[model samples]
Target chain A: MDISGADLVRAAAFIGAGIAMGLGAIGPGVGEGFVGGKACEAIGRNPDEAGLLTRTMLVAQAVAESTGIYSLVVALLLIFVV
Target chain B: MDMVFDTVSIVKAGQFLGAGISIGFGAIGAAFGEGLVGGFANCSIGRRIGMASPYTRTMLIGQAVAETSGIFALMVSVLLVFGDFSANGVCAWTATLSAGICMGLGALGSGVGAGYPALEAIWGAARQPAVGGQMTTTMLIGQAVCQTPAIFSLVIAFMLMFRNCVGLDVWPYGASLLGAGIAMGFGAIGSGWGGGQAGGAACEGAARQPHLRGPLTTLMLVGQAVAQTPAIFALLVAIMLISIGPTEGTILTSAAVLGAGISVGFGAIGSGMGNGITAEGACNAISRESSTTKDMLTFMLVGQAVGQTPVIFSLVVALMLMFITFNIPATLVGFCALLAAGISMGLGAIGSGWGNGATGAAACKAVAMEPTQRPVILTLMLVGQAVAQTPAIFALLVAFILMFGNYTGPVTLPAAMALLAAGISMGFGAIGPGIGNGITAAAACEAVGNRPEERGLYMRTMLVAQAVAQSTAIYALVIAFVLIFVV
Candidate 1:
C-alpha cells in the first residue's frame, strides 16, 4: 500500500493522457466525416466540381484534424514528460 | 487485506464521495437545459417584440421544470453530506456511495432533456404566436415525460440509501448495490435526452401545423414512450440487481454482478438517445408533410426498432453475465477479463445505436420529401445502419473472445491491465467511426432523396465515405487484439 509522490503523479499523468486523446479524437473524427459527406453531396450534384470539391474536402478535414493532432501531442507529452 | 477499516470511517468516506458525485454530475443537465431556455427565450423575444412577456413567462416555467431534476440531485447530495447514517456496515458504505452516483447520473439526462422542450417551445411561440398557449402546454407535457427516467433514478437512489443490508456478505452485496446505482444512473441519461429531443420536435411541429396539434401531441407521446424503452430496460435490470439478497462473497461473483450493471447501464444510453433522435426526425417530417403523418409514424417505429438492436445486444450480454456462471481463475486476471467484456460490449453499442438513429432521422425526412422512394430510402437507411453497426459487432466479438477465452499464461498484473486496456481501447474507439459513418449515410440518404435518379452514384459515394470512416474502428480493433494477444 506504500506509494511515493512520483507513483501518484505518474498514475495521474497516464490517466490524463488517455482522457486527453480520447475526448480530443471525438471532435475531429465527427467533423472530418461531416466535411467529407458534404463534399460527396456537392460532387454528386455536379461532377464538374468533383476535383475542386475533393481538394476542398481534404483541406477541411486537415483543419478539423488539427485539434486531434494537438491532443495526441499533449498525450505524448503527458506520457513522456509529465 | 492488511488495512483496518472501521464502520464510521468507511461511512464518512462513502458520504463524501456520494455527495460530490451527486452534485457534480447532477448540475450538468440542469445548467445545460436552463442556459438553452434562456438563449431561446431571448431569441424569441427579439423575434416577437409584442409577445415578449408571454415568451418570457414560458421560458421561466420551462427552466423551472428542467431544474427539478437538478434540485432532486442537490437534495440527495445534501442529505448524503449531512444526514445521519444509522445503518453501519459494508451495506451502509456501498449504499451511500451508490445513492450519490445514482442521483447524479440520473439527473443529468432529465435536466438537459427538459431544456430542449422549453427552448423549442419558446422558438415555436415566436414563430406562431397564435398557438403559443398550446405550445406551452405541449412543452410541459414533454418535459414531464422526460423527467420519468430521472424519477426512476431517484427511486433507485432512495431505495439504495434506505435498504436494510444487515448481516449481508460484503463482496457480492456491495458490488450488487454499486451495480444497481450504475445501471440506473447511466440508463436514465439517454432516455431523458432522447425524450427531450422528441418533445422539442413536437413543440416545433405544433407551431408548424396548429390544426394538427392533437395528433402532433399524440405522436410525440408515442415517440417519447418508445424512446424511454431503454431506460425501462435499465430500470428493470437495476431493480433485479437491487433485489438480489446476500450471496456467497466471492470476488468472481462480485465482478459478474458489477459487469451486469455496467453492461446494461452503458448499453441503454445509445439506444435511448437513438430512439429519441428517430422520433425527433419523424415529428419534424410529419410537420412538413401533414398528408403523410400515418406513413411517417410507421417509418419512425420501424427505424426505432432497428436502432434498438445494439441495446438489445447489450441487454443479452448483461443478462448472461448476471445469470450465467463460468468456471475461471478467481484471480484478478479473470476478474478484469469478465469486467472488461461487459465494458467492451456496453461502450461498443453506444456509437452504432446513435449512428443508426442519425441515419434513421435522415431517412425519415427523406421519406417525407419523396414518398415514392420510400422503399429505396428504407433500404439505403438500413444499409447505412448495418454498416454503422460494424463497430458494435467488432466490440461484441472482442467481448466474446475476452469472456470465453482460455488463457494458459500466468495471471500477472500486466495481463490484467492489458485485458482492461483492450476493452477500453475498443469501447471508445468505436464511437467516432459509428457516428462518422452515420453522418456519411445520412448525407447520402438526403442526396438520393433530393435526386432519386442518381441513387447509384450517391450509394457509391456513401459506401466509400463510410469505409473511410470505419478505418478508425478497424485500427481500434487491431489495438485491442494486440493488447489481448501481444501485450
Candidate 2:
C-alpha cells in the first residue's frame, strides 16, 4: 500500500498553514492584553473619563488587531490560494 | 524502489504545518493584546460597577475589534485543514513553511508593539483624564506604525504560498522558502519589541512632560526607524534567496541554503532588541534630563550602532554560506554540519543582541546623567560589549569547524550527534555570557552615570562580577569544543 508524491505535499502544506495561523495569532494576543490592561486602569482612576477612554481603547485595539488580520489573509492564501 | 515515496504525504504534512502555524501563532498575539486591554478595562468596570452597562458596550467594541484578527486566523486554519490543494509535493511543502513562518514570527511584533501604546494610553487616561483623546490618538498612530513589519510578512507569505513563487529547484527553493519565513518571523521579534519600547516610553514621557511631547514623539519615531533595520535586512535576504537559482552540487549547498535563513533570522533578533532597549533608555533619560537631549541622542545612536554588530556577523555568515560552493561529501555528517552552522550563529546572535541591549540601555542612562563621563562610559561599554561578543565567537568557531572540519570517515549518528550537540552546546550555551556581560556593562554605566568619582571601584567590581558571570559561558564553550573535537 502506497501513496503518490502529490499526496505527501498536500499533507505538508495543510499542516504548514495551520502553523502559520497559530503563530500569527501570537501578535494580536499580546497587543490586546496591553490595551485591555490600560483601559481598566483608566476607568479605575477616573470613571468620568470612561467615555473617552473607551473610545480610545477601541480605536487603538483595532489598530493592534491588524497583524492578526494580516496573518489571516496569509493563512487563507496558503489554504485556498497557495 | 528508486527511493519512491508517498510524495502526496510529504505535501500534506507541509500544509498541516502551515495551517497550524498561521492560526496558532497568529491567535497568540491577539489574545495577549486583548488581555492587556481587557485587564485594564476590568479595573474600570470594578470601580464603576454601577456604569457597567455602558462600560461593557465600550469593552465589547474594543474586544470585537481585537477578535477580528483571531477570527480571520480561525477561518484560514479551517480552510487549510479542509481545503483541496491546487498544488502538491515540493511546491506545497515549500509554501507551507513559507506561509507558516511568515505569520508566526511576523505577528509577534505587531501584537506586542500595539499593546505597549494601548497600555500606555489607558494609563495616561487615568493620570490625565482630560487627555484621553490625545493619548488615544497617539496610541492609534503609534500602533499603526508597528503594523508595517507584520504586513510585510503577510505579503511574503502570499507570494510563497499562492504564487508558488519559490522558483529555484526543489533543494534551493526549499532553502529559500524556509529562509523567507525565518527572515520575516525572527526579524520582526526585535523590531516589534523595540517599537513597543520606544512608543510606550514616549507615551509615558509625553504624559509626564506634556510640554516636550513633540520632541518625545520625534525621538520615538527615530528609535522605531532604527528598530526596523533587522526586519528590512531580513526582507532583503529573503528576497535574494528566493530570486537566486539553486546551486548544482552536493547536499552541502542545500544545507547552506537552510543555514542562510536561520543565521540571519536569529542574528537579527539581538540587534533589534539591543537597539530598541537603548533607544528606550535614551527616551527615559530625556524625560529626566530634557536639556541633555542632543547628547542623549548621540549616545543612543552610538549604542545602537554597537548593538547591531552581531547581526552584521550573522549577515556575513549567511552571505558566505550562500555564495560559497563547499564540496563536502553528501553524508549525514555534512548535513549535521550545515544545520549546526545555523543553530550556532542564530542562537549566538540572540545572546549578543540581548547583551548589547542591556549595555546600550545602561549607556543611555549613564550619558544622560553624567555627560562628562562620556569617555569612561564609552570605554567600559566597548569592553563589556566585547566580552558579550565572546559567546558569538564560540559559535563562530563551532561553525567554522563544522564547515571545514576533517571528517571524511563513514557517517554515524553518534558522530552526527556530536556535531549537532556542538551547535546546541554553543547556541544555547552562549546566552549566559551574553546576558551577563551586558548586565555587567550596564551596571558599570550606572556607576559612572551616578558618580564619576568612583570610577575605579565601579570598574573593578564590574570586571570581577563579569568574570564570574562569564564562567557559565566559558563552561558552555568548553563543552562545545568537547562535543565537536573530543567527542
Candidate 3:
C-alpha cells in the first residue's frame, strides 16, 4: 500500500503536535510544583506573610506556565497551520 | 506532495527523519547543561568579584565537556543526512532510524548529569578558592563518569549505522534493531543523571571540608560506579538484541524479542536515578561527619541494592521474553499480550525504583544526623521501601499474567487492544503511588531521626500515608484485570 506525500505529512504533523504538547508540559509542571512547594514552606515559617507568599507563588507559577502556553500554540500551529 | 522522488524515496525519507530526531533530542541535554553552568557561574561570580575570571573559565570548560555527547549525536546526524544509501534496502532504512534514536536519547542524560558537577564545582570554588584545583578535578571526573552511558549509546549508534544488515529479514529484524536503539538510548538517561548528582554532591562536600577531599572523591567514585550498573545492563541487552541476526519463528516471536528490549531499556532508568540519589545523600553525609564514612558507605550500598530490585525484575522479564520460545499461534492477540506484558513491567518499575532511592537518601541523612537512631531508621526505611515496592510487584504480577495466560478467544481487534490497554493501565498506574509512598517514607525517616523517642508514632503515620497512596495503584491493577479478563 502506497501512501501519498500529503497523507504522510499530515500524519507526521499530528504526531509532532502531540509530542510538542507532551514534552513541553513537563518543564512547566516541574517549575510550578517547585514554586508551590517553596511558597508553602515560606508560609509555614511566617504565617503573617501567607497572603504575600500566595500572591508571589501564583505570579511565579503563571510565568512558569508561559512555556506550556507556547507549546500549546506550537501544537496548534502544527495541527492547523502545518 | 510537491516533488516525489522515484526509487530510493523510502531510504531517503528514513535518513532525513533520522537526522532530525538525532539533532532534535541531542540539542535538549547540551543546551540545558550549558544553561545550568552559565546560571550557577553567574551566581558564583556575583558573590565574589575577584573570582570572575576563574569562574568564567571553569564555566566554559564545563560547558564544553557537557557538549561532548551532543557533538557525538550531531556527527551521527550529519552522517545520516549526507551519507549514501541509494544501494541499501529496507534493512538500511531501519538501521538509520535506530542509529538516530540511540544517539539522541543517549546524549540526553549525560549532558544534564555532567552539568550538575560543573555547576557545583564552580559554586564550590567560589566559596573555597584554595581548593579550586581539587574541586575542578573532582568535577571533571564526575562529568566524565556521567558520560559513560552516552559513550555506550554512541558505540551502539555507530554499530547500527555501519553494520551489514543487507541480507537480514526486513520486518522482524527491523523491530529488533529499533528495540536495540530504544534499549541503549533510554537506558543511558537515568545513569548519566544519577552519576552526575553523586559527583556534584561530592564536589559540594569537598568544598565544605577541603581536608576530607580524598575520602569525598573516593565515595563519589563508588557512588557513580554503583549508579552506572543499570546503564551497563541496558548496554548488555542492546548488544544481545543487535546480535540476534535472523528472525526465526513467527511475528509473535518478533513481538516478544522487541518487547524484551523495551522492558530492559525503560526499566533501567528509575534504578539508575535511584542509585544516584542514594549516592548523593551518602556523599553529603560523609562530608558532614567524616567519622561515619565507613558506616554511611555501607548504608548507601544497602539502599542502592534495594532500589535495584525493580530493574532486576525487568531484566528477568526481558531475558525470559528473549530466550523463551512460545509455541502460540501467530495471532494479533498473542502479539499484543507479549508486547503489553513487557510494557507493563518496564513502565511499572520506574516509580518504585525511584521511590526506594528517595527513602534511602532520607535514611542515609537521618543515620548521619543521629547514629544512635540507626536501628530504628534502617528498619523504618526498609519498611517504607518495601511498601513502595508493592506497586512494582503488582505490575510484575500483571505482566506475568499477561505473558503466561491462556488466550482461547477469537482473533478480534478489540481483544488485542484490550490486552494492550491493560498493560498501559497498570504501567502508568504504578508510577505515582510508588513515588508518593517513597516521599512518605522519607518524611517518616526524617521525623523518626529528629525524635527517636516517637519512632512508633512516625512509623504508624508513614504506613497510613503509604496505604492511602497505594490505593491508586490497586485501582489500576483492578482495571487492568477487568480489561484482560472481563473485557
TM-score, candidate 1, first chain: 0.97
Give me the overall lDDT of model 1: 0.82
- Interface RMSD of candidate 1? 3.5
lDDT of 2 by residue, A1-82 (tens): 1335654454344434434433444344334434533453344345556567656756765786566566555545544554
- After aligning candidate 3 to the native by TM-score, how far in Å is the CA of B386 from where it should be? 0.8
> Which has the greatest lDDT?
1
Computed on alpha carbons, the lDDT of every model, listed in order, comes to 0.82, 0.67, 0.80
What's candidate 1's DockQ score? 0.28
lDDT of 2 by residue, B52-144 (tens): 564455445444444444554554456566754435445567666566767766776566666666666565555655554566555665566
What's model 1's lDDT at B457?
69
TM-score result, candidate 3: 0.85
Candidate numbers, best lDDT first, in rank order? 1, 3, 2
* Model 3 chain B poorest ten-residue lDDT run: B460-469
After superposition, which runs of candidate 2 have C-alpha atoms over 4 Å from their true positions? A1-82, B1-9, B41-79, B86-89, B165-169, B245-248
Candidate 3, superposed: residue stretches over 4 Å from native? A1-82, B1-7, B86-88
Compare the candidates by DockQ and give the number of the best one: 1
Model 1 residue B385 CA deviation in Å: 0.5
Angstrom error of the Cα, residue B125, model 3: value is: 1.6
lDDT (10s digit) by residue, model 1, range B1-487: 6789777778788888999999999999999999999999999899878888888899999999999999999999999999866374667788889999999999999999999989998998788788888888899999999999999999999998887787776688888888889989999999999999999999999988988788778888988999899998889988888896336746878888788888888988988998889999988888988887888888988889988988888888888878877677787778888888888888888888888888888888888888899989999999988998888898888888888877767766656656776677677767777778788888888877687877876777677677766765665676567667864
